[model samples]
Target chain A: MEIALLLIVGGVVVGTFGSLLGLGGGVLLVPLLTLGFNLPLREAVGVSLVCVIVTSGASASVFLDRGVANLRLGMALELFTAIGALLGGTIAFLLDERLVAGLFALVLIYAATTMLRLKPAASEDVATPTGEGPTGAPAPAGRLMAGLSGPNYRVRAPIAGATGGVFAGTLSAILGIGGGLVMVPLMHIAMGVPLRIATATSNLMIGVTASASAIVYLLRGGIDPYAAAPSAVGVFVGAAVGSRLAHRVDVRVLRVLFAGVLAWTAFLMLRRAAGLG
Target chain B: MSASRPGGTLEIRLAQLLRIGTYGAVILVGLGTALMVINGRSPLDVAPPLDPSRLVSDVLGGRPAGFIWLGVLLALATPTARVIAALRAFIRAGEREMTIVAGSILIVIALGVVAGTAGG
Candidate 1:
């Protein structure tokens, strides 16, 4: 009873933070399960992956509705991400758990450091005014359609997106973190996608990518349905709330706090990897 | 070319499908969890191994844990459905490239499910 309650509350908190920050809750959930609950890393990861799916399912729809997510780009990128997830999921069972922890810690540290950087200029600078619009915001003109809306943004360099997808998918599977931490940056910085569009599109792809690996976890006996159920439910509710609150909050403040949390999580993961936790 | 609308018809449908699927799954999982707690069965650290056949049997057998698993299965299926929705939308739009992309993703997901079931 106590464990079930704890997992549900923990998942809600993680999901709120993740949705606010454009992450998918796995980054926080993995460390929480492993360090706070003292579950095995593999089991923790399985639970985290489930949470990621819930977050994706809960949040991506809103993003797509708002016209912030480019579904066409997401679908194109998912092919690579799914392929990478397959390779990573297959390799996960063969690798040492400690190595996985170490890699996850490194990713956390890298993410935190990157978050300290200012917003990318590409989001604001590349304003090719295709037509006049309200607020004088240049309407993006392109043939790359997203759903029924005619064109979203013109996607460039499919090869670059694919390459990034490979890395994102591998990390997502092995570390049980949503690949968005990497994909958002890759799209925004490397592929010249707008930040909002990048995050939303990343959200859209996460479920498919996680599902690719989650199937392996489910079949391989890594998932604990008991742990995952409450967590997933909590995340689903929390993501809905967080998505509503996202616009009101100051993102910079959240970023700073999240970076601190990431740093601390990295330290805890490293400690566990060293057999000290 | 600029977008003709705020959200395309396909995007709206996808959003609606996802919202319904996820929220419904949450309700089912919540009910199942309540049942478990009421029955004095705690799923704390137990990882029950189940195949699809066993899952059906258990659910039909009035097992609360089965409902939980079913909820998860429903949640997982949403993504697959989304891919199919995208494929249909793309084909309708005459986006041959995008239709192929969605189709490829569906194939990958199918392969994963097959391999996972086989391995288990």
Candidate 2:
């Protein structure tokens, strides 16, 4: 009963904020599980991955409907993200728990700093056309460049996007957050994707990226649905609500608060890594 | 409304599929959660590790833990399913490069699943 309550509550909080920030909230959940609940890092990671999928499903579904999600862009980038996730999952099983903890701490700290420095998202230009012509169907592209670039805008940095995707995927699997923490900024800063598009695209891809890692954890018998189920439920619901409320909230304030949480979590993770916990 | 938006039909279909999957998973998981709470103990509470096959069987057998596991699987599968849908849509649209990219992603996912089984 207690565990169920904890998981559900934790999931709701994580899901709400995660959706608001265009993230999976795994970073927050990992620390919560490890410090508050005292679960092993790996177990927490397993649970976090499940919740990540739930959040992804909930938010991305809406983003797609609104045309905020760029499918072509997401698909193009997912190649490297999936590859990285596969490698990350394998390494997680092989690496020392403490090392993973230390790395997770670094991820948290990085997430905090990034959130702190993140500029306000550029204006909402998410309603990009879907390339439906007068005939109400899309035109066929004959070449590789056209296909890769898609119909929205040209992707300026395929190489950079791939590198960022790889980094995001590995960190996502290892840290349990949606790779959006890495992806959103990478797209905005390095790839020159608009902020709204960057976040939407990140949201769309996070699910596929997490799925790759989740399979490895599931096959390894690492994922515990009992621990993850209620949380997943809460997160799904919370993400729905968050998406609705996102526009009303002050993003800067939220980022500051989230950064604080990340900082604290980073401290806890580092403490555990140092064997103090 | 730039020149880079994907085919509208493809995006809509993928979104619809994902939404349906999310709803389905949530409903199943919610039902199982209610049962678990009422029963006062979950199969996963301090239980031994089980693989995907056993988990599916148990879920099919109407066990609460099984339902939860089924839900999680559905949630995980939703995105991969989206990717598959996109791949098909791209192929139908004759976007050869995109088809290859989607196919490669699927292959990677397949490899990950295989690795999980092997590593486990």
lDDT digits (tens) for residues B1-120 of candidate 2: 222254366677787898999899988888778778887875247643655568768767766777787787788899889888878776777777788899999999999988898998
Quality of candidate 1's docking, in CAPRI categories?
A: medium
Error of 1 at A167 (Å): 0.7
Question: Residue A133 in candidate 2 has what lDDT?
Answer: 29
Q: Which stretches of candidate 1 lie over 4 Å from their true place?
A: A120-153, B1-6
Q: TM-score for the second chain in candidate 2?
A: 0.82
User: Which portions of model 2 miss their true places by more than 4 Å?
Assistant: A120-153, B1-7, B42-44, B51-57
What C-alpha lDDT values do all the predictions have? 0.78, 0.79
What does the lDDT come to for candidate 1? 0.78
Predicted candidate 1 versus true structure: per-residue lDDT over A32-95, tens digit per residue? 8888887788888887887888898888989878877777778778889998887777778778
Q: B102, model 1: CA deviation in Å?
A: 0.3
Among these predictions, the greatest lDDT belongs to 2
Candidate 2 lDDT over A43-138, as tens digits, reads: 889888888888888888888787777787788788899999999998888888899899999988888998888766443433323333234444
Q: Tens digits of per-residue lDDT for model 1 on B1-120?
A: 222233677778898888888887787788777777777766564756656778777778767778888887888788888899878877876777777888999888888777676776
> How many clashes in each structure?
4, 8
